[model samples]
Target: MTARETEWISIPMTVDVPYRFAAGRYLTKTLTQLRDNGRIFAVECPRCRRIQLPPRIVCAQCHVRNGRWVELPLEGTLVAFTIMFLPLTDPTTGKPHEPPFVYGSVRLDGCDSVLDHLIHAEPDRGKVWVGMRCRVVLRPPGERVGDLSDIVHFEPLPDQSRPGS
Candidate 1:
């Protein structure tokens, strides 16, 4: 009856739960546009003028219905990122994204929210950084399937240097 033995132990496990549901009005419109035309769309909050991606029906801040549709440019800035050292399964495709990959949240120009996706860049610290300019790389129109996966990944734009050097 030692105190160390009485301490709680933690265990990690993976649970595979398969499910499907409808992508309501807002998201459906966003995905459809990406799939059909390779265009990105978001909803603007009438009151606050905040543009949201993966458009939602109501504004999370203003509590008003989002009506105005805004087409966002493919280019944006990387707001945050991580170099993953583990092989993580992509829930959307059920495939494992190999380790040591770079992924991050990108705020597309003129939009308030950010999109998270893989970044096609070396995982070296000297290469990727916050505020890196990037562009969405989408699958060809005919190959798209109306899902976020329609976007292959974000590619860093050329001729840009880090803030300090």
Candidate 2:
């Protein structure tokens, strides 16, 4: 077979798969609180006292069942980040996000874990930083649909200076 005429031909197909996800008690509580009360919730391991997002049944570090439920502050500090330049597919919608979006992990105040999500700041070093202060912006109460999608994005709080600025 010539290089131009390969033995195998490629065919593209679209999938119309439908499915549902079970969040269990731990996640259901978190998602419901966010959707109904406009709040972020986490769980802490009674042993290590490390708080975790998504409120797991057991702590990975301590291997202890988390018992304490805590509400996290809306504000947080950016601990790590990346400026994505590709059309990353969103798991929930099965669609690609617009390119050049700022995404990052923010350690919410009074919580031991960092929640990662889309950052609303410009995808630039000057605008985004490791220690930048950000606030979670959620959809309107009536518009919330009991999922993480209710979070619009993390926007930088006003009057915050970039590191070394």
Candidate 3:
């Protein structure tokens, strides 16, 4: 082989890096309650009175210490959503989930912050609407871990139906 053609080609490799995260005091309380009691908890700002999920010590908007803990209802309004056609890898599990699934952001009742998660609705606009009502469906208490993934998905309420149906 000629000297120019003898160049070695480098191959690309993927590394799986494992890491651990400590949920702070506020989040630890929220997650513990979620895992143990199967209930959702949010923190509220003393000044602005905005309730935020993923309970944090400080409120982002008001820039004040969050002092109040609120138990949020499972039901919420679907504020935004999209039909994901791409193979998206779930960072938590480090696995690529199947494509053409519906995922969306929901604003839980009595909470200012929105939570993003998988929406258990058909991948069609006709089935999913922006103002659709949804409730969180969590994994069984025994199967639950102290993480957001404990929520299996948000399922749409059966209030709306097709006109012909």
Every candidate's lDDT: 0.94, 0.92, 0.90
**lDDT over C-alpha atoms for residue 118 of model 2:** 98
Candidate 2 has its poorest 10 consecutive residues by lDDT at 1-10
Model 1, range 48-119, lDDT digits (tens) per residue? Answer: 999998899999888999999999999999999999999999867779999899999999999999999999
**Candidate 1 segments whose C-alpha is farther than 4 A from its true place:** 1-18
Per-residue lDDT tens digits for candidate 3, residues 90-113, read 887779868799999999998888
Query: Best candidate, lDDT-wise?
Result: 1
Candidate 2 residue-pair clash tally: 0
User: Which runs of model 3 end up more than 4 angstroms from their true locations?
Assistant: 1-8, 162-165
lDDT of 2 by residue, 101-127 (tens): 999999999898888899998888888
Per-residue lDDT of 137 in model 2 = 99
Q: TM-score of model 2 relative to the true fold?
A: 0.89
Candidate 3: residue 138 lDDT (0-100): 90
Angstrom error at residue 64, model 1: 0.8
Clashing pairs in 1: none
1 or 2, greater by TM-score: 2
